[model samples]
Target: MEISSPPRSNATDLLVSTSSDISHLTELLTAAGLELGPGGTDAHRPPRRVLNTPRYAAMQARFDRFGSDGITMMCSTAGLQVCLDMGERDRVATRWAALHALGPVLLAVFANSARLGGRSTPWVSARTRAVLGTEPARTRRGAVSGDPAAEWAARVLDTPLICWRHGGPDWTAPPRVTFAEWIGGALPGVPTTEDMDYHLSTMFTPIRPRGYFEVRYLDSQPPQDWMAPVALLIALFEDERVVDEALAAAQPAVGRWLHAARVGTADPRVAGAARAVLDLGLRSLPRLGLPTDLHDEVTRSLDRRLAAVPAPHGGDLR
Candidate 1:
């Protein structure tokens, strides 16, 4: 997952595995002639693809109309997308909600990309801002419920498509024209099943659900450290005991998505919650039987970030 989407400096992004295999990933990138962008994911990256078809360029044009060239390029954000296994499809709904809320904690821990468009910014991950700010209805999540599929379907219908089908005099709809409205005869023609599927694909939320849950929000990191966040999240989700503890500790961060993007670990509460999650993640590593190198990377990352945080006036908490 390219945390740096529609990347600011380049026309391309690093295609990462949805799973965590740091060394295999390095080999793949090397083979593909791609190098991980230096340091921060969104900082100092050059200005930069989409579906093929006549609609592709039109889709890009609509994105360009909304914000920066980087955004249109869809290279402004990147993330870790860990997939939770689905047993007979209905099983993972609750976990989906858990991951949605826990997403911010991951962001707080791996908050890189302090600069975007080659300009310094206060935010740790400008990539997060670019993604959530893209189009509220689509980019930002709507309502999540116990029924993940139903909520997601409703959200897909509720969100206005970025551009209408190409045959119209103007491909853009009047502001807030939802796909449901188009299906209900508000648009001149009927919306096909294909149209519905394609529109859903454009809806980028902090977390998205397919057969597996897609955890989005952590910024793209350097190759050496990128695996830490992935390992941490996997440790939490794969182990049920850690999941409970992580969720309880991560609760305070549920709605701090925007704040996490802005102040990142600088926000004391975010740092505290992230540390708790990381600690829990560390505890699970040995039992999870993950490799030694991955264990070290996660430990080092958690220690470095938590150590950067100053001791409270009373005392050190961790």
Candidate 2:
């Protein structure tokens, strides 16, 4: 279910070619009486292997208190996460900041989930809305500052634990208890390095930093259009200059997660910012050394998206 490109390889090109395999697989499944898209109905009833696992059991137990949002997110929705290198150590802060700044625009641009539980929803990215509604403490976007590493470390320790491993069936941490409290002997056992590693894996922040940048904001794209966002992101973050330019272009929509998920590019302000970001990404694409046809495919995808919106909202990309 996952495809990883080799290190320093061209992700856009790989996605473009790999899509054929995906399409073929989809056809095979369809012939066998299977259908596939963004949403699914199996959230309420996961497979035994998935549901019976200690990790999932504990997670479900913890999320039960929050209502059905967590279950819906885990069961129904799909995402097209893009992971990239953190780049040079000195430039990490800049890249991190730029990604956060550009996140809302990206979310709005690729918003796809419009329905949940067989009912039409107001939000464009209903999956994202479900994520925010489930748990803000651990799932929301992390605060950006000059010191990302320190801020992230502190945030990790301060946030309440979802679950921790134990030999017994019950892996759920005590309600409202944080990892910091466990480290201070609030729990029966001492915290270890492995425990810290597991804790990091539990974080569901919009952008997860684990020696690499995991862009988790994007909704799963349609099969034919999957590579557009990937190419645009690569181009935007490929150079410092592009990152700064894209960040400024998307500044108007910064921190507007709810708005982006609700109205998407329908809002003139968000639409304007999205247009500029897409244009900037397009302008920077040539530097990526993509093949002519592949580059044109990306261009067409971006153009199609831009043209889909009303003129009043989608201003000229120039």
Candidate 3:
């Protein structure tokens, strides 16, 4: 399941592919019996009540084999996560565009891991919850609006460094200190400009607007379905019409990111946006030469989730 590198180009027309590296990681884990079930166990049972040692051993063995590298594992502070390489020049812009466009689609595609603590957590994507909980600056933010590169750079420079890996726990600083502050000599240490730059690189948010915006929001979708989000994102960005339509449809759910992340497709606004986005996606799929069946699958899933929204206790939609 090795993911090939994307074609070398900053052209909007380039079809951005989903990295197979993540697929390999997930498959290895699953093959080793590390099933990503709701709460990591079956219904009517407490989570982690039954540990599978052999499965864990297999996973450890696999990890030991591949090991780590810069491109292989970015932002160790945010955990070993795979980030798409969008070349050098427009890295942040391309990453941001891909992330924002693909966020909801990925969320829909990888809507497994619904249960937590051996109980349904009302979210269809609990793995996403675990990701966002990784670090504040990296995973907490909502969508971005404006030039991707400048915005990303500004945000990164302003976000305080949570910790420097070198200094350990003793290197901690005031909670609100920004990278700018550290560079301005506000901290005890006479931090260099290079230190500021390095610190900025570590911040991870769901939709980072760095040189290439990274979509850190999706759960580990099934390997087979991995291409769905990638395809949807490429189509949406490459086609201006699709981008406009998706933006229009997702507007209602703009400020409700927290609600969406918390309850997933359960919330009416989130569900509505999901439906709109899928419908728009289906209409644009033909232009991209992608199979209509994929769009249909997305549409059906959204419809099913929307229909499953529980009736209000008092019969009110609110």
Candidate 4:
């Protein structure tokens, strides 16, 4: 598929959200006869017919056909790829801005498998669980560092690969083989730095800092809901005051990342975090020149989801 890059300013930063089991979700899309590329899965893909032209009509048609299957619409600005660009001092800041900005938007846009095991799951976002289950280092929320690029590079070197897609078959590497190991001749191909970079790209995580940090932890939301997260992210990050508010709001629930994904809005901690984040997002919306209604709707949805389900057991939510 030809992926058209968004405007440079918009595409510079990226946020990735994945279903609980993205591989399975990809399979689902394939079964539905849709091909997903590096961008998103199934209905989430930009309509093939609309490339290089107005997307409104085609986007609407795709939504009409498959929006209810829990397809999420995400945004990526051209700015995100600048990590590969040299002479950028504010690269990490831009990435954090994107991530912080996208948090609530992601929450709002979240749509995922409502059913699992051939039955309707109580949670509206089962994809969150699926992605969480895939890998811990990549999906789990780690300590956000001051420099996302450096932090991501260091972490990438440490995270072991789940599987490597070689030609036609996936060669399963040792679970403990870190990027550092591969780079330092552990894998024995005298891997180059470029190869190491490519390897890092393959390790899917919630907060990854390559050329850009991909926030791969959200369930696909409806198409109409796409702009909410995009707008929210841009607002929160670009504006200093909004960033402060967001961090404050996110702090309360920072510890609940696992619970939020595992039990979603059900876990009280997760609920609290959702509420806090939503509250902050609403307060900041006006300042960012975005709509507060989006914030309100998202907050309401999370509240309802939390109230309806009981928290799951185990070692934190995915």
Candidate 5:
């Protein structure tokens, strides 16, 4: 599933093809005790041990404390997670901010989960709703300003620890204990650099920038449509001018997370923003070096949605 150099001419096809191959292999294995598993955003089935790993067991125990919302996200939700390189050093902050700014537009366009527990829900993406309901200290995006790395560092230190991995199965940290507190000797043991690295891994912000940007806002699409969104993302960030255009197009809907997940494209501002970005992505496909057939595939898939968005309105999505 690794693309050594991403956005390669057939990168989207490569990813989708790889995913299908894995799914086929998984289907064969399901003849044993395993099942291919549920799709969409949420399935209301009660949590069970799918993997018997120690870290997973410990993390599940911690999530249980956050109530139904946290538990629901931990056990029931899945997404189409995209990881992109941070790009050049100088433009990294700009790219990071642009992605966050465009999040609502992209999310609105791709919102797929409309039901939970076998009943229809109001939200377009119930998966996002579940995440919003989870503990904000860990789940929400970090404030972006000044230095991207510094802001992220401060945010990480300020977040409450989910669990501290001890050799035993009970990797629970004391309630409400922040990592900064641990560093300042507020807890019994001295924390090390390794502990900090593990703590970084525990934070679940929407756009996590490790060595690369881990885009987590998009919902899981139906199998046939997954490639479209990936292609759109590749095109949107194809160059700096397009990135700026994207940011401007999405500005009206920026930070409107609740609106995006609820009504999605039904919200006029969100719809307009989505349309603008979709147009930009489609046009940029040629410059992206995608094959003519792939360009046509992405365009056809996205154009249907574009045709549905209303023209831009002055009202704020929020």
Candidate 6:
């Protein structure tokens, strides 16, 4: 289902609506000689195992230009699709900047991916680090501007174009060519505005812009514990006063995305801010009137994080 406006959208209602839909989907998949893989059930499974068909090969080939080399039949990574409702259009850019800033702490709090190539990986969220390790500029935290659309438009043009459609055997771009340069008659024919928009989608960042602010850093969690991060996100942003406190709490950890992904909560600064953010989310639970059971589950998830932080060489939480 689609949730265009989440604040204006009812969480309970959306859950009721989507639960049945998900169930139906599960049944259909089961009937189609397919089954749920050990993804959410197990953290060690490959996050993105895709079917290597020609279409997928082309897609992976494009990513290969960046730096990805894995072979599988279907893509499989799961994470909460979180969107914070910001009511006014006028302040979107400013609000987006604020949300974008909170990304590192969130990544630390929900750093769940501990596996790569079906075995334990060094990074707390190896999935995230691996993605960031790709074409550096495009994979890091995205840019923020006072005017989001305008800034995003500029970012799309300025970032290097990965590959474009053509009747050639190779889709690789010329060295040091950017979409902006292409627009100015650099190499291949100038692309349309729609093409530029498509290029923006290819770039990955913590915060992806939609009508509601989308946070993309949280890793795929255990199926039972997935809702906590989503709740944390909502509780932090649902009220203006809470938003201010959370932002201030996250100040020290700002721009520390790589650190957060690597160290998880063991990084002292991220741990402190994460504790504050988790505590703040707990405080807002009553006020927001979210489902008690789900919120309680979220509380348990946060409690585990506070009690144990991932160590660099050891997988044991302490």
Candidate 2 local lDDT, 123-150, one digit each (tens): 8888888787777777899888878999
Q: Write the per-residue lDDT of candidate 1 for residues 37-123, one digit (tens) a residue.
A: 644444665545634444555556666657773352375445555555443445366566668767777776677777776788777
- The TM-score of candidate 4 is 0.58
Sorted by lDDT (best first), the order is 2, 5, 1, 6, 3, 4
| Residues 1-318 of candidate 4: C-alpha lDDT, one tens digit per residue | 222233334311332222223445667788999744321233233223333322333222333333332112212101111121212565456446435443433442344445443455554455554444445565455456566666666777787654443343335565567767876776756656666665665554555554544455555444333344444445455555555666665653454444453445555445555555555655555554323565465446544543444334444334
Clashes of each: 22, 0, 12, 34, 0, 7
Please list the C-alpha lDDT of all candidates, in the order they appear.
Answer: 0.65, 0.80, 0.50, 0.46, 0.77, 0.64
Q: Is candidate 4 or candidate 6 better by lDDT?
A: 6
Clashing residue pairs in candidate 2 are: none
| Residue 161 CA displacement from its true place in model 5, Å | 0.8
Which candidate would rank higher by lDDT, 3 or 5?
Answer: 5
In terms of TM-score, the best-performing candidate is 2
What is the clash count of model 2?
0
What lDDT score is found at residue 313 in candidate 1? 35
Which regions of candidate 2 are displaced past 4 Å? 1-8, 20-24, 38-50, 312-318
Q: State the lDDT of candidate 6 residue by residue for 92-188, as single tens digits.
A: 6656766776787888778776665567767777666766665665666767666778776677677776666565655656655788898788885
Q: State every prediction's TM-score relative to the real structure.
A: 0.78, 0.90, 0.61, 0.58, 0.88, 0.79
lDDT against true structure, model 3: 0.50
Model 5: CA > 4 A from native: 1-13, 16-23, 26-39, 43-49, 52-54, 311-318
Per-residue CA lDDT of model 3 for 135-247, tens digit only, reads 54554664454565666667777776655433543444456677778768767677776776557656656664333435566554444444455545555555555566777
Error of 1 at 222 (Å): 0.5
Poorly placed runs, candidate 4 (over 4 Å)? 1-5, 8-111, 146-150, 162-175, 286-318
Model 4 shows how many backbone clashes? Answer: 34
